[model samples]
Target: MAIGTLDAAAAYGRSLKTLAPAIGESTAATEQHAGGGNSFGSMIETMVSDAAGSLRTAEAESAKQVAGKGDMIDVVTAIGAAETALDTVVAVRDRVVSAYSEIMRMQI
Candidate 1:
């Protein structure tokens, strides 16, 4: 990866952290008062599904490019982004499952 790209990725990750609190606040408010059917878990599931779909699309596009229609760099970048997003979702799922199991095992 180019140095500039690495820097940009780092900046984007930092920006995401800054947005986290706002997202959490909005979610909390919605849960408490919106009366909507949306829950945090459902939102997370939707995000995961979207990410997976994006990954599949990226892969398909990349494959098509190998047949000589798309730009290699764009395809590679899309695949990388999708892979990273999937990895993040899996890590979050593992952590949530582990925490639930631990809570279940606690003596109350």
Candidate 2:
């Protein structure tokens, strides 16, 4: 809604490109011994996998706390981590959507 939001989104998109090659190199290493595909896709896959794992851990810890088998501090920590992961995923999704929209707006 604001110019600053667009600026931030663009910045994040640029940052993602900067990080992509590190992901690509790791993906290339694994794929070289197996087969090959898009490293960007692999990077996204890894990101989603990690986010899901974080949410699962948070749920498990909450369950343990409910059952009185986990410490409150540990449960809180896990939930906080999960929340942060979810926030990051949401932010990335927003940036991706913003980038795609900008791409579609090109006169070409």
Candidate that scores best on lDDT: 2
TM-score of 1: 0.60
Return the TM-score for each candidate structure: 0.60, 0.66
TM-score, model 2 to reference: 0.66
What's the lDDT for residue 3 in model 1?
52
Tens-digit lDDT track of model 1 for 27-96: 6554433332355544454556667677888988888898898988889888888988878767766787
lDDT values of the candidates? 0.65, 0.69
Per-residue alpha-carbon lDDT of candidate 2 for residues 1-108, written as tens digits (9 for 90 to 100): 555433444454455555656666575555432332455544454556677789899999999999989999989999999889878867877888899999999999
Model 1: how far is 108 from its true place, Å?
1.3
- Clash pairs, candidate 2, are none
